[model samples]
Target: MRGRFARAARLAALLVLAGTVQAAPVHASEVAHPFTVLGTPDRRDVVTWGASADRTGDAVADRSYRLVVHTSVGGGDLRIRLSNAFGDRPVTFDSVYAGLRRDGAELVHGSNRPLTFSGARSVVVPAGGVALSDPLPGRLPAATDLVISIHTPDAAGPATGHWMAMQTSYATQGDHTAQESAGAWTETTGSWTYLDAVSVRPPTGTAAVVALGDSITDGWQSTSDLDRRWPDYLARRLSTAHTRVKGVANEGISGNKVLADGAGQSALNRLRRDVLSQPGVRTVFLFEGVNDIKAHTGVTAQDLIAGYREIAQRVHAAGKCVVASTVAPFKGWSEWDPAGEAVRQEVNTYLRGSGDFDAVTDFDHILRSPYDPERMLPFFDGGDHIHPNDKGMQAMADAVDLSRLDCAGRR
Candidate 1:
């Protein structure tokens, strides 16, 4: 009995020592900050824009514009993203400013705040380049609107915009000092384009949205500098709802395909790099496969359906919600053969009917003309019979049921 008691006591002491070692204080670096993405329900009226000009050979007026954001949240710093993602030459900016709007017309005369990139007042972004601004000192409260003004000293090149997800943006000419003179200019010189994204350090539990698609998803033809794409519309809707979601990430690559390689690469090939790899990506809205049907002459609808299923499975495995969007109408393409239409119908039918996705967004129904079932709505078509106009994109975003997503699950 004595021997057994002694052995038990020894084991108890050993266990207690192990517990003490395990309870030792851990360094902060050893502990990771639990990432949480919060939805911004009140700042739904806020949006962002980008400008990229194509200077073919003329000394056109300097391209300049202002961004107005109606925010309900206060005390947070504002950040901007500028890009030359498709420019042919290096683009330089003379100055950038952020200020309050005077009577909702233009930037307040004395309220202009200079912006910088890496502590420098100017940035020279090369062709296919991007830059993120340092955090600015702007305290925007709920219901108040803020404006961002950018000025360039030289002519801007021919620029294409990523529309559909930006809420609102404005373009104007002249420098910041002359911003108050709204009606003084003979004609608008420079251009301002709205984009699908902005950087925000939202409160805890906010997640960002990823709009994954092809050229149509990338906002191919809605006009340079106008945020008139369907995803931009969806971003506006989500913001208006005051959900704490972060912002939308435009993952669309022009000429991208679903199964085969083309402009960038196959959608499946880039999924990890584009969708799964982005920060705060809680939800992925996919609208691809039209190019696949158009590119391959012998491929069947079943092949496209299988490709979609594979993509969905990969997204689900990542523990994110996959919202499948049907391909928009594309009846007038020179390569849009009759056989391709049959495949399109079959693929869309499966997308609408199959339970393969967490939810389905019907882009086909929104862009298709009611009068002509095979063609797109006349006003919505961008003369290409594929991509939607600003208004058409807005309608597509409006069709989504925002409540189907969990705003708290984004991080």
Candidate 2:
């Protein structure tokens, strides 16, 4: 009898040391997965997936959408952010459901769950505003395809969504969001509508990195439906590596510039919404300015540098680190010229030596050809020469040092 009691006590002690012993009952929405570091568990919400929102199309009433997005970190109580930032009128979401994608628009059996806003099923998001769903109770695994089904009952006027998503989503008429079947979701779209970000509660110290850039960061040339973007590769690395920053948000807009609004809001204008507003972001990876330099917009190297400085200042004020990347070589593109090349060279030099950023990644060195020095390596170049192929995208992600991402103690 004494030996049995001793063994029981030892088992209890082992559980406590492993941080697996339950102490108190927590609300479903407030629960987190069992994850511990250094014998303690600290849980906080971190962005697992994100896309930048811009004006896309006119809204339709009583329309249902099944949006498929990829996750980066595994955790519980998933929340999603819906955007109306470019809308001229209010939008009402009557029903919203989240589930794991089985195949195409179909969801895993018994995995579809409804999401609410402030205890209500419907949420009315005002123009130029964003609505975050009250977290649904559950654990979401890393690198899984999370399908968000949305039903907009009275949506109208200009709509806000991410264009050039590269991933295929589904749409249909009526409130089919409650159904897990793919029958009603026949229409397919290459863009994600309304939704901008998805978050999950992981270990408290686990942070996320936001990649802010243009077409390359948006995975333009990479094969669609594969999630082969550079940032996606980075997220894969963070998930398996010995690092606390496990989430990655790709805020790249094709043809986007740093100083002006064209394809989407400029990096400076959308910085807060696209980077800082994201939950648990620790670093802003700046990889823009190619569009500005190539457009002949009279934006000098000094002007671009000033813009970078302002971004760094704002990000620092928000208590986050900045990681800037040297613009990659794009010599064979239609807009490439000697003058633009000079500006790019000067900017690259500044990014390498500025000391303003917490760390710098030399994308130029990684993608540029040694023989031609000014052109992208033939093996890595996509057809346009401005963007990279799948191999090059992976290379870019591999160059990022995982250790530099943890900016917890540094000021």
Candidate 3:
């Protein structure tokens, strides 16, 4: 009896250590967190736009930023979330505004509006904290270029942001949050800083699905100025569908892993903040693991499967469904080998057969070439053979059955 107990204890310890990836502001919830509900019992606020936060460089002081992001669903009372997740000190934003973008560094004349934080014009977000803007009462259209301008007069710690936004945004030296002209904004950048999410109050029963992935979903190989990520394409599909999952949140990070924290905290580490913390989330669309499998770190099929099971379990525990996808083929990438290919096949087979997730999307089959079997189709290849081009991204989105994302099954 003593021996058996000791063995079980060791096994438990190993499981805990293997699953852990260090992230600040960790959640200890064994069940779904009862965060502040957005609306009354009849309606709710769903996440219309989201981007994962990673530890980039340091923040610049007295800088005015005009970040542009694309929204998935249309609703009223728009809200935005500013994150200082990796900062070591408090960062204060003295001025912030939201408006409809009109060309380079320009905003619609009457559409630029001020955003308050708890009824104040300014907000100070502490390290590892998020500040949600007070909802602006207005109609926001889906697939619109929503530009948010911010003035950070005092910020000098580690910056928290998404580095590969695949969208062009503007920055300058002064506080021009309410400007409609392109003059004040003089610099251009491809990353999205400080800002992370945008939410909106939708009609009754309108819910959302959050896509949790890596660079493929982050639009690495796709055209830079165009919103052509697989998740972006998926969002477009959800817009015209008659399903409850109208909103889509792209929570993907560039060069992110599932089992370790490299580019950002692993998927398991950031799941709570990036996926479950959002309002009215009904499903989590998970598509990751190539980095883990090809790291040449001896990550086996079982290891990847273990990660998938844990992700699905947590989502289910939160009363949400999981829509997992098989990892796409990367046979031509430099890291590919016989061992990695074997592991990929094993993982994909399990993803298709395992009954652990609520649903499965066969991304491997969709992206793989019929002739090569182990390679991506030439037309879809992004030169690296690991990522898919814009056309391939759209194909993956079109393959998804929009009805499967309906939240009715979860309810």
Model 2 TM-score relative to the real fold: 0.89
Top TM-score hit: 3
Candidate 1 residue lDDT tens string, 226-297: 555666667677766766553566667666778776565467765653455444456778899888888855
- In model 2, which regions exceed 4 Å deviation? 1-43
Worst 10 residues of 3 by lDDT: 11-20
In candidate 3, which residue pairs clash? none
Candidate 3 structure quality by residue, lDDT tens digits, 1-411 = 222222222221100001112221334531231122211211367899999988879889999899999889877777788888788888899999888887878876667778777667787877776777776766677888889999999789798889899999998987888787999898999989999989888787888999999999888999987899988899888888878788999999988888888888889888987888787788899999999988998898998999899998888877888988999999889999989999999999999999998889998999999999799998899889999999999999998878777646664
Quote model 3's TM-score. 0.90
Give one digit per residue, the lDDT tens place, for model 2 in 160-184: 8998999999999989997989999
- Per-model TM-score, in order, reads 0.60, 0.89, 0.90
Clashing pairs in 2: none
- Candidate 1: lDDT over CA atoms? 0.58
lDDT at 93, model 1: 67
